[model samples]
Target chain A: MTLIAADFGKLGRSTLMSVASMLALAILAPVLVAALRADSIPAVKLNADQIAPRAIEELTGRNVTRDYAYAWRDLAAASESARADLLNDYFTGFAKDKLVRRIADQQKTGVRIRYIDHGHNVRALFYAPDGGEMQLVDNAQLEIEIRDGSKIIYREKVNQQYLVLMTPGADRWFVRSLDQLADHP
Target chain B: MAKMHSLVFVPALALSLVSSAQVPTLQVPARLIAGQAFTIPTHGQGEKTFYLLGPGSVVKRTVELGTEVKVTGAEIAAAGRYLALSCGSDGCSGTDFFVLPGDAVKISFLLHPSRVPVTAHNAINATAFVFDQFHNPVLRPVTVDFRVLPKNGPAFTKSVKTVQGVAWSEMSPAAKEGPVKVIATVGEQEEPRVIQQVASEACNLRIKARRTSKGVEVETDPVRDCHGNAVPDGTIVSVTAVDAQGRTTVDAPVKKGIARTQLPIHGSATISVASGVAIGNEIKL
Candidate 1:
């Protein structure tokens, strides 16, 4: 009986110690990994303007259709920044040409897209296919009429919503899917 | 005993603590279930585990924790001792949990059985038959995924598949009155997959009349229902008798189940039943 008790005590102590060690390791390992990897984590961000000119020119040389197809491909390849650039080019072109004629025109006449805002990693510029350096502006708008003062500009109304994506590398921002805003004009 | 209890409770307590932290953190919407297979959001995936518990301590089976799991069908056997889930062996054990969509939280019982019903509403006769996943007649309220296919017509390729799911009709009276073919798929693991098909005839207003040896008989017998049931008796019956050139004689108060008035020696009178009648038969009255 004494031998059995001694053996049980020894087994219990080992099991308790092993389980405690496992639990402590599980709890501490992630923290340790985070600390070691902290330097690699994002500290500064790159906006569209700050993006490498070579990367921008490589992206812009492709037409809008090619840009979108390449964007989808890049997204599949996990090159999210390239995808963002392609998307920016596509939307900028769309806003310059289609937004006024199709969307804003339906509400009122002679509507123009002003200056589009690109923040963080987003690059906003209007691309004219048959061009000689046309001025691409941010025609996107945001309204907080209920809390803030409301104002109407031009014959057409615009509403813009932007989203910020914080990934392991850095923080990048982009516009949501586009549709023109109208204010009972 | 306290130590033993702690051994059991500690894990559960820790799991609850972990889950509470996670509940508000996840922004993913509930999963949309497709036929048989469910796609989990690969949150940097290797294996994602979920638990499937039976009535009480009974654990039917554990499924693989992977990005994709397919459920061909399911059935209740042994009065619900085990849920026979259909799948290829992918490291499933009885002790493991069956991962289901988050909506499953709405349910209290694990082994809830649902049924798919097919009713022939406007069938002229009782030739209509309803078959379950096993091709058996089921006459109880059931919750299951269903698809509708028309006879000699293209079957709807897309089906509404739901888990944590009940046929809306099973829970509400309004769903029963509809004319729809419902197919139900269910099960847990192993040989428990089943597919049930239900056919319902739409409720339609139809008029039927037969000529008897007796003079110009006009009666509403076997009122056709669009949903495949014979029309009930005493539904306000009105009928019109018209001569060849559209000269008409409208009759009054022909009861729904039986509407009849003898017409004098007729040379093919066009008999038309009223639109308000559940069913109307056109015959020489």
Candidate 2:
């Protein structure tokens, strides 16, 4: 009876060791497979040409360019009462006030400034680290007519350069300042 | 006492004579056209130098007083307000006048968009600016006739009066696909322009598909409008495939003439296509 009991204990110890080894293999098998699979796959290195056509740097600048075009169009197309409402989307602070005053003065003088054709080239000058402010320089060709009362007193083609400051708002970028560079013709 | 009185009286008399001398009077026309000969009348004695200042020009000449100063078109070519000053040994006087625009010599006509889709209430604007020979904008109210010639359709005509040197009108494009000719006429001067009219949208869009090695290849017939005109290239056509696994969609643009896409199908599926708001017939595979 002692020999038989000692033999049963030895068998139990061997069976426990086998079960523990099996359990450890079961746990480590998935990790080993995953590592091997990861090693088999090639590392991806993206070239500049493979990047998206519209880079992150250009996204905000494009919005400002489109808004600038619309702002000038609204100025030429809106009525007296509607001018302020139309321009509210494009300008802010002192720029907005200045545009409003200019429109009012034009209305009082019976002056209508019509924009015939406008084309512009925008170059990004600076972008703030916080992404709050942006500066752009625009070189533009403008065909315009200046009318006084019932007479178009002046008509010409003008080449203009502007230093534009913009700030991001809740919906779109707003023009903080549009100062005309005096050096351009 | 007599000599003292004469001294005081002589100085006073001289002062009165100088002050009483008639100031030169200048006569100028109230309105003059640009690039036209004009004359300014002055009244005085002895030779007087006159300076004429106007937009884009300046003239200084000595002329006999009581005569007129003649100016040619080249001298007073620019249209704006002008000032003429007469300065003599006796006194100085000045007068101002306005220069108006001359007759229409050329027309600047602009048509927006350069292309349009044929739909009612889709408006295209035509704006005209009449200019003089010297390129000055003519301010007078002139009648302008706008004519639109459509392919295989009746031509449209309208007359508009210029206000502040501009005449603009809005017209709807014809309901057909072809080149459109627009002409603006004022007297003998005419400006001709062209705009391309394209089909409105895709209608009756239908597609067919067959099994391929890669996936289920599906392609649309040449898309057409209700009038049977082929939809222009680059119009977006959307294709959707629905199977046991959910749905996949591809928005393909029309190239050459059709929009085609391949979808991987697991089991029996349904395919549908659409262009703009127009939906096409669906097929079960």
- Candidate 2 residue lDDT tens string, B65-109: 778899888666656545566656655456556666679877877
The TM-score values for the models, in the order shown, are 0.20, 0.51
Residues A42-92, candidate 2: write the lDDT tens digits: 111111121111232555645666677665565445422224566787788
Taking the tens digit of each residue's C-alpha lDDT, what string does model 1 give over B126-210? 0111213222212122333333333333444222222112211121111232233334333321111122223222134344445
| Candidate 1 lDDT tens digits, A48-136 | 34221113343342332233233223222211111122233223322222222222222222212122112212222221121211111
- Per-prediction count of colliding residue pairs? 49, 0
Worst 10 residues of 1 chain B by lDDT: B5-14
Interface RMSD of 2: 27.2
List the candidate 1 regions with Cα displacement exceeding 4 Å: A1-141, A145-185, B1-218, B225-229, B232-238, B242-248, B251-256, B261-285
lDDT of each: 0.28, 0.65
Looking at candidate 2, what is the lDDT of residue B212? 90
Provide the lDDT at B244 for model 2. Answer: 90
DockQ of 2: 0.01
